[model samples]
Target: MTNWTRKALLLSVSAAAVAGTLTAAGAPVAHGRPAEPIAPPLAWGPCEPIPGTPVPAGQQCATLRVPLDYRVPGGPGVDLAVTRLRTDRPEARRGTLLVLAGGPGGSGVRRVAQKGGALRAATDGAYDLVGLDPRGVGGSTRANCALPEADRHVVTLRSWPAADGSITENTERSRRTAASCARNGGPVLGSFSSRNQARDIDRLRAALGERKLSVWGHSYGSYVAAVYAQEHPNRVDRLVLDSTGDPDPTRVGYGWMANVGPAVALRFPDFAAWAADPAREAEGLRLARRAEDVEPLFLALARELDREPRESEVPGVPLTGNLLRQALHSSLDSDAGFAPLARLIRSAQDPRGRPALPPGLAGAIPDEDASVMMAVICNDVRWPGPDSGYAGRVAADRARYPLTAGLPANIAPCAFWKYDREPKPVRITDEGPSNVLMVQSLRDPATPLAGALRMRAALGDRARMVTVGQGGHGMYLGNGNACGDRTVSTFLVTGKRPARDSHCPN
Candidate 1:
């Protein structure tokens, strides 16, 4: 997940009074409900933009009240922070387009602020771009596990095995984390599941007074969008699932996590090629003279660090093998991250040089951010119990995929998470309208092309996937692939899709 600064918005008065009745399946109950299904009107005003992201001139913000628990719609509520940028050319406007952010903890309000202008221009002002901070995200009602500072660090939170591939410490951390969340997070944290996020989007839809919403969901958001499309088939207009993963209901987030080791193996060659390029020598960033040599060099450095960690710019935090491994995993997400990663590797190799850790690796994340990231994954489905042979799996995975060092198959907090009350994950099927489109990169470190094929197959004829001959996590307005970007933009603006599944050569 990208590091994002939190920006809190003021809660509106609409939250004080319940406005709609929702069923367990997220649909509005009609006959038996005392109140109509209509959502309360939003009170739009200026947005309190995130530090680095400026809200566009016409962008407006509002507060939306959704149920704290869908099963008890009339009980306590949580406020979602929403943002909208209406089209400048209203005459040519197609409809409202919702932009869903990734991470399960990603801030959609910030996403709209960062990408709204480019998206507006890309579609030729065809859509009123809109986004929201799902519960426990930035600007929305939050839940905290009050976890220890060490446990909140990205490397630790990811449950990376020790240098020796022993998961003893990882297991302890996972159990403690699960206990802390259950003790402190209460119902708000438990409600941070994908299905609840989908329900929140539908609430946002009703609040906007739009009969149907066109969606652009990225990463984890793609799964939430798929769940929404499955639950409310008739309410979707056009859907775009970007950088999606396998929608296997039984596994859900666990499946995504398990695929990461192999995905990194698939994507590492791209970084290796870039690091070995002749042009990088002029920039003083070349890691190896040949592409194949880069892997051994990295593995050797990591093993050395495991034996003797190097001091880093962050005073208390030394650069260890697992930290280096985690950094590599993150750096593989984009080409822009290559140079910094190469520089860190060079610094680590120097006996007297101190490496400057990437911001994400340098410090512990916010409690709220860590809380949502853990909650969503753990709440969505059941993971193997504590005695389910995680150490053996880690050993096998580490031998099979050294780049990730068995981190993907390692024990997570979900293993200790209480699953007695959690609902089964929603299955993504081909039952929805054929308006769905998936844009995927051939080599995505987080969500590989192979997993994307699973999503495409599950959607069957209901979806058409555009496989870009690129390597990264996100596509369409990202990665600067003109062909892929144009295809998504054209589909959004004119509703024209490719004749069938197609590929865009790099």
Candidate 2:
């Protein structure tokens, strides 16, 4: 699986800016003040519509006030941005299910709005759908490092190297970017870590009057769910982890990025098959007569771009090797993205044609999103202190997984990040409730089968996994086989986990 897929598979949330101590010392304390009890009837207010959004009917928005530091509930507080779709079938209602979005920075409110229907349908309307914008995201308390727009651009922020594959530019950029965030991003920025997100989820759970939560966590959200399950096992009723991560505390963000190479290599064949099909000729994008030939052609084309970029649809933004690779990386996550990639490839090779671009490359991730992503990863763990170490790993990865080149193993802003890890990483264990049900794709490029196996083993007997014999991430009702969907839905509605790990054939 590709690293992004794995990270995506783990949950929608990425393991970026996760720092702080999950120590006993850090636990919420009352000091001299009594704790505020969670009450019924949530304080209702008008939700600030998401920028470029249309509010759905019956969806209510509100602010959830939580302790800034769980230990000092009375000292200072923060507001959690939240949205809810109350149970459509109140007569059949079970309780509330929270949608934990991935990306320590991703907005849960948006995810719930987008995916709430699917989740409700999947559960047969057993629960209400709730999503929250984690701290530092939209509608919640926000923060920014206010760095130059150039440095803040997505491509630069991700540490994508220069066209020639040199790390000097990436290294320097990482250092400068880290320095800027440290200088400008303040205390609020420090609070945007994973541990706090878990705390916030718990706070929301308490606020909602739900004794237990049935959770649907995507990408980075899976990690958050796993940690929540570990911390408050009794508070969980049913759990679904989509597109999971390695969850290896030792590696954290760096290890997550390093896996990208193999992830791309694994998912590339699916794209190759689609591009080489006879049906694709009408699109003017077919690259090979046979599927095996696609990787070599892509590699050659990337190398050629490395030597010389071609004019792209985006003015001044030449289609360089890294850009092509990143596009391929993004596109391969779903079958829907195949056409744009093929069109781009065809445009690049076509003397008179233009390759189309994916939206991610069309523009940078918004500044707020970028800042949150950068902050959480750097804050979550301390990266290797030296550039040489990254260089060595990059060279080694390039040899082992040439499809992604050395991009996965390359230096990121975290390498030169300002803060050291303040908390020990949460080790996901099987001690959580057996209510967890994991759904995964067999041929997923992002969160590969091998990594999911580790998650399965870790959760041992405490969970059951349904393996969809298909490609892409988020197997449950998402680019997955019917059998897989049925398996997850059955477990979610009936609380009947599979007796053992099972497979769903395409």
Candidate 3:
């Protein structure tokens, strides 16, 4: 029933290219969590197709019924949106490996189709690739805030402060937003927490009929995978966490935002170098004659925008300081994005030039995505409530991390969020298999090396991490060097992770 063809078309663009083969083991280690016999095979069938996308040649889609609430297994259930790209090399297939997408809001069913080929090539066709939309995301059951179109805009959804450091506006907006979510957001919204996402993953494993599941998770997905492994350690065969987060329970979104300061500071040099390069001159995007001058120039530009908002393609929506900051925040996530940001800075600083707006400034984030991104972080952990508490933190954070200013540590709508965490946060421990392989970038603007180190420390000897002396979020064929990619691919395919933690030279 699925629009297999439509799905395929959308996925082909994002999927990685496949290459040479690598042979590896299919069997799990004997003494560890004994592999239980595989469950009864699922009667795989055609998926209800999404119009305008193609299903992989042999892949199919099915709905996995999971409890709406994990604590009550017999309660009403929701259908987890799922898809599979089976291993072409069945003889080499070990088991099904599920891909957990980043963003409690990210769609994984689409991600598999995008990255399937490269992933298969990475593991040498050793496992079937699969993914799903967590509850309250696309193609799964969903929830919406009924938020105003203006508030749904990305710039506003993230809680950018007023042109000045005055968060008076942000504070009022945060309170109203919290009230809106509590009002219009329903039962499914409450179910968007990470705990239930982990439970849904386990149900998906059972539905797939696998004795054990390997995982490749990115960004927020890394947090979900970490929690999953903690809750169901015996169910995991191998795990790969890329672009992880701080597992600190005390300061959920607060810590995540606080981290952005240093994360951006770490990433600023990358932009500076790119902006100063003579090569960027051809694009009329060079910002500074020297690399080191770029940061100060940007600080000046932000101050300029703060004082006099510049009009762009989006009428009435002048480029504000927070918008510029958010732009920098998004650009640092990937290297490919650096040039555009450099160009923007160049245009903004040009005396006679009026630059165009960056893509989607006026566009609306889908209602469901808006709800989950805010909900998951707020619902998973608590946030500080007092405005004075945030003011003091912001002032200190701004002084220490000028690149991100006080943004990372600023208050969000979560401060006014109604629902408390449903359960204690899952604490990642070193009690699992020795099959996990972590790949991280040294200067990731989103998930910094510092946090990844926490995850590595938590996993202890149960894992081996390959720290790439490079910058950018998402590693292992995403932003990593060949040696780093080779290391992770080797572990995924062969089950031979690093004998110890190692570093990949820049």
* Top TM-score hit: 1
Q: C-alpha displacement of 206 in model 1, angstroms?
A: 0.6
The per-model lDDT (C-alpha) reads 0.81, 0.71, 0.71
For model 3, state the Cα shift of residue 182 in Å.
Answer: 1.0
Q: Please provide TM-scores, in order, for all candidate models, with all chains considered together.
A: 0.94, 0.91, 0.89
RMSD, one per candidate, in order: 5.6, 4.8, 7.2
lDDT (Cα) of model 1? 0.81
Instruction: Residues 1-506, candidate 2: write the lDDT tens digits.
Output: 00011112112325322221112113642322324345335676555555444556677788888767666757677677788988778888888888887676777787776677777877878888899888777677766766666665445666665665568888887777666667676667766676678777877887887778888887778878887787777778889998787877776666667666777777788888988899978767788999999988988998888888877777666777877877777676678878888778878887665555555565555555566777766666666775458777777878788777787778877766665335466677877557888888776766776777777888988988888877886676667889988988888788887788888898
For candidate 3, the lDDT comes to 0.71
The TM-score obtained by model 1 is 0.94
Ranking by TM-score: 1, 2, 3
Compute the lDDT of residue 62 as modeled in candidate 3.
67
Residue 241's lDDT within candidate 1 is 92
lDDT of 1 by residue, 62-144 (tens): 89999887667798998899999999999999899999988867888888988999999999999999999887888888888
Candidate 1 Cα misplacement greater than 4 A, ranges: 1-36, 420-422
